[model samples]
Target chain A: MITIFGKPLLLLYGQLTLGLINGAFYALLSLGLAVIFGLLNIINFAHGALFMLGGFVAWALLEYLDIGYWPALVLAPLIVGVFGVVMEKTLINRLYKLDHLYGLLLTFGCALIIEGLARNEFGSSGVPYPIPDELRGPLDLGFMMLPAYRAWVVVAAAGVCLATWLVIEKTRIGSTLRAATENAPLVQAFGVNVPRLITLTYGAGVALAAFAGVLAAPIYSVNPNMGANFIITVFAVVVIGGMGSILGSIVTGFGLGILEGLTKVYYPQASATVVFMVMVIVLLARPAGLFGKA
Target chain B: MPMSRRALLATAAATALPVRPARAEKPTLKIGVLTDLSGPYKDLAGPGAVDAARMAVEESGLAAKGINIEVLSANHQNKADVGASVAREWYDRDGVDIILEVANSGVALAVAGVTKEKNKVYINSGAATSDLTGAQCNANTIHWVYDTYMLAHSTGAAMVKTGGDSWFLIVADYAFGHALQRDSTDFVQKAGGTVLGAVRYPFPSTTDFSSFLVQGQASGAKVLGLASAGTDVINLIKQAHEFGIKMRIAGLLIFLTDVHSLGLEVSQGLTLTESFYWDLNADTRRFADKFARRQPGRRPTMVHAGVYSSGLHYLKTVGDMGLAQARADGAATVARMKATPTSDDCFGPGSIRADGRKLCPAYLFEVKKPSESKGPWDYYKLLATTPADEAFRPLSASACPLVKA
Candidate 1:
């Protein structure tokens, strides 16, 4: 309840943390988008829908099979990743020889069909997913109380994002993967099995989205329209972060989330629009984006 | 005198095609339940509303009277243009006599305009905008259930009396949200309370409301007003509870369905205003019990109850007037409907006003605590009842031309 000019600093910290929590999601989601776009040279327009599907899968596992949250956290991503593999092999693999727009359109259409089917089955008032029993209460800081689950979301998301960055940047497998993106035929000539790598990369990218979805289920109720709500804002995050830079995506996601939170406290009404405004400003100023290579 | 055989044959064939008679037996009246069956309002009004109407028609025994009634339904998808188009097709091509259960205010208003132009009746049970009977009022539309004004007035006045003085609002940014804010602000001010601060979130888009809640919490207001409905209201309440906001939350428009979605643990002690509650009395419970048999595991919200009440009243009026006469003139049918008293097991005895607002008592309900052990769907405890005359805006205050005339 620390007040500066009648504005509570605790309230400000709470909002910033909330923003950071949202940014954690943004960071995770944009990282997946950037990763998929980097190797596949195609935007996974269905990434958001996959994220939503992850939540439903987790919910279904809990509701139907009596499986708990901890297992579903791991299982949901694996299931969605396999689904992404199948999608890449059967549908998306054919479009690689065509224009990039075909890939975009094909994935966009896939997203719509998936969302429609989910809506038809679930009907849109979201089913609530309760917080895990251990994480039910809030942490009592001297100044303010923060929900334990939300704090975990930020910390866990940052860990995952950093781990993903390290896997791509400092590993031997990452070099080969980057090489395949630059020259698939050359990489294949070097006996790297580039086509299989492409499929697996897409799967991994989609799995990242599903992972975020599982994390998000308890925060936002599981609903068909959940993905559509964040997809546009996430796209803005990707654009501002640069489409192919992993670190850039993570930084930009968290930064914009915090900025949006600050805006909510200071101006309130412009919070939703602020992220997109920053996107526009960034695009106009640096066409290649903050971390994008020309 | 020498008429050709070809001419005689042509005249005979023309008469064989069956000319429509100037005076015919009464045709079946078609009622369309156009509402959101797939979007956010689906659980609030969707198929339950349709089932409620069917139940009303079944109970009316109109079939025994040699009067046939048909119920047609479609999913409006919560879009205004789509609702307008559905209303047009129902009225013009399908011969649907009246439309009911319009849920979204934007869509409801659009359908209201369509009804006016097409000379058809629209009984709005799900939408909550007073403008339907106020500035945007039409001769062809009856705002059957609750409206934002009634809710704001009931909830605001009650909270103010209970010592929740200053307020902050997290409003959904839309027509319905704006109307609720405006109406509630007026009531709060009149009750000698002040609105400290407020924020508007994009309707249905901002799934996260933590920032908004923090702002409200920081406002140091005694009461926090949730001027949103459906999942938005449910989510905000759950988050606020987790954050441990000490302010008394006044939920302006919360349906029973929302409470059911959020269990008693999170929803307990929430004060809201509703026109009808299933567990209110014997009549309401009886109707609700019967509705449960049809829906199976789902309880009736006020909107669902509104559909039944309005549907039954409409059928009774049509039966008395004869379907043919009712269909011949839409305005006259509506006028006759206004003249009749609205009595059903759901709402009990009520009546419609000149501005097409259905007059009924509204109740202030507090959600039952978890320790108050009860069976499923046992949610509310009645706190106060605002009588029919005081529950809504006065006719003299309405900007409707019909009210003025």
Candidate 2:
């Protein structure tokens, strides 16, 4: 059996671990996407650009100012969040009452403009962000050697994903936000300042993407086009997980990453297209996703 | 007698004064810098090539002459169709006399076809496929800079010679990756290495490589060659580290830009072959220093360096004569460049081969350990220098139609 399978157990475990790491990013990005989709009902094509901007912000902080990772972590999200707020107020809000497609289009245009400006300014080559001193080395875990930074990324992303889910699922503010999303007129009658809440919500969602970007900067090259590369995969992940459920998105994100990892081991050629292929299968078999509320 | 002498002088002046000055109209030489200005390949070509072109113009002092030179640029978006259309437009309408820096192989091939049709010149520095000079070779196109055959021969053959044979390839499932794998395999086998096994990863894949690494680890091959670049290279290295597949991993064609991006931790101890390094020699240092003054903190890539050399050669030819004369004098100009021991700010004293490949010494470099000290960008330790003759695929081995003919 072992001879026929060629170390199937080890391969599967390795693939799953890889999948979980990828899923962590997927979960974080999709969670943000879901939050925005739930309220704004816009695709937010610029989400990836914002994520890339977050990474660039972190890189700039380190490269130009000698600010460490801890500070950059806090500063990058805040800076990106502010940009998000400006983007929402100046551009996104204008398209709210119009066709939802306009919001998508506007965000898409904003994404192109942002990516173009960054590429023009920085060029397409990736800039390196040093791993923080605290998370520089590898930790031996019997079967595998895990880099402290990658492990941190997986954990930190999960923590953020869970905390966001908790906030949305529980708490009075969460209920009010949900109410606004379902029926903004009623929430406004309750004197909740629904418009302000919506604006903040969009900003918060963008902030999540930026946060992920900041985490990814040290691991991946801080390139202008970094977000564009992963955004399509995240969209496919969101589709597979079903955009309707937050938890589903999280599970699917991590789940697919592992599946992709396994594909790499067993059938390397199909590794790249496996996720999209899975998305197709899920859409055909269970349209609402595995953990979705259908 | 005085009146007669004055008449004679007036007659001499009248004969000396030229009648057809309009026939010697200053020729405007249009050179197209086809680069990815706003796409994934942009950093690899784009503005850097533009800057190189400007440097060439300045270095050649072409503007000082009566010749008028103009440079135009476009982004092909890594698509052959787009590149073809742009090349056609530039050739037919825009009067682009020469096209340089077609980055993507697909795009390069497309532009090569168009240049052939238009009877224009192409100096390809960006594309990696040897097929441009091989099966796809055209009289109008010159494959400058490095190609897959050079990379495969330099890295693969060198590794095999050093006894790091028995290969496992983690190839990107694309034309570029496939060709690289095929070419490298031939060199590996010829150098007395065995191909243990191989696998292909999808292009632009965003996932962990734990599985692929495990398969490679299980292959038991002394060398695991990564036939990929950019994000795939980054992810593979990182994931390979995680999976503990650190022994004898080889990057067939990794850019210094990629090494800079990956940093020391991910890139450390990995060996790769490169035609140009910023810190190669005194001339390179001078060129890189000047480049840094403009770019500020970023290093000049090989493609950028190639652009400067090719552009300068073009301008020099045009300056010596006119655009038509320069184009006609291609062989002579190329020979002159080869005859002169070429020294530049980027690569010092590299010779251009007859087959249009730049024959500079390649370096086998190992990524420096984090503790090796220094600071950021202090990444590589020169393991061995493969000389110009030894570094590239021999003329006899080249399938380039030009070489065969």
On DockQ, the candidate that comes out on top is 1
lDDT of 1 at B47: 89
Off by over 4 Å in 2: A1-4, A64-67, A139-141, A286-294, B1-25, B238-245, B264-268, B319-321, B327-355, B367-382, B403-405
Please give, for residues B76-155, the per-residue lDDT of candidate 1 as tens digits: 98889899998899999999999999899999999999998988889999999899999999888899878999999999
After TM-score superposition, what is the CA distance of residue A284 in candidate 2 from its true location, in Å? 3.3
Clashes per candidate (backbone, < 3 Å): 0, 7
Model 2 DockQ class: acceptable
Each candidate's root-mean-square deviation in Å? Answer: 6.2, 8.8
Best-fitting candidate, scored by TM-score: 1
RMSD in angstroms between candidate 2 and the native structure over all alpha carbons: 8.8
Chain B TM-score per candidate, please: 0.93, 0.87
CA error at residue A22 for candidate 1, angstroms: 1.0
Give the lowest summed-lDDT range of ten residues in model 2 chain B: B329-338
